[model samples]
Target: MKKEYFRYINTLFVVIPMTLIMAFVGLMRNYGFGEDWIIKFLKAWSVMLPVAYFAAFVIIPNARKLAEKITGKS
Candidate 1:
């Protein structure tokens, strides 16, 4: 893979588990560990994954800048 591909690869690695865990935790909290819980989590994760992946591209850079500004480090 090229260097440019790593950025997208990183996003996929980050987003998949992040959304999966978040979806699981959120639905578990709301609905408990019922039989339908995995189904619900799958539905939520599918929706969240792409949205979160794109949002990360926007949010991560700004967040890094903000952190640098706050901490006086870059």
Candidate 2:
């Protein structure tokens, strides 16, 4: 509806799946799968979520602008 509401929902939708996938891959890469892997994944996801949210809001718009400029897409 509103821009603010949409921003939050967008962040949630993007971050949740991304964090889940990346965290699983990263933890498994570093520590390997085990009973403790779930805990490690959740902890890493928790830490990453805020940073990812911040970057999505702050960086993505500028990045899109840069891409548009490079492609002359306007």
Candidate 3:
């Protein structure tokens, strides 16, 4: 119960920053910084947030397993 929710919280923490940085860099690279950059970033964020969350949700568990294997821990 409580532990299960921990993974979701971890995912949110990871996804938000990851998506924010990626969105900013990607938009800056393609569009350049300008007055409308905030708007564009907001739009990209709306799309990327859910996508990244889903990807992380699926990928994180398997990734942790692989890490444990690689590190010979757990």
List the RMSD of every prediction in angstroms. Answer: 1.4, 1.5, 2.0
- For 1-74, candidate 1 gives per-residue lDDT tens digits of 89999999998999998898899889988999888887898899889999999999999999999999999996
- Candidate 2 vs candidate 3: which has greater TM-score? 2
- Candidate 1 lDDT score at position 56: 97
lDDT of 3 by residue, 14-41 (tens): 8999999999999999999988999999
Error of 1 at 17 (Å): 1.0
Write down the lDDT that model 2 would get: 0.88
Tally clashing residue pairs in candidate 3: 0
Kindly give the stretch of ten consecutive residues in candidate 1 with the minimal lDDT sum: 33-42
Error of 3 at 64 (Å): 1.3
Which 10-residue window of candidate 3 scores lowest in summed lDDT?
Answer: 1-10
TM-score of 2: 0.85
Predictions ranked by lDDT, top down?
3, 1, 2
CA lDDT scores, all candidates in order: 0.92, 0.88, 0.93
Off by over 4 Å in 1: none
Best by lDDT: 3
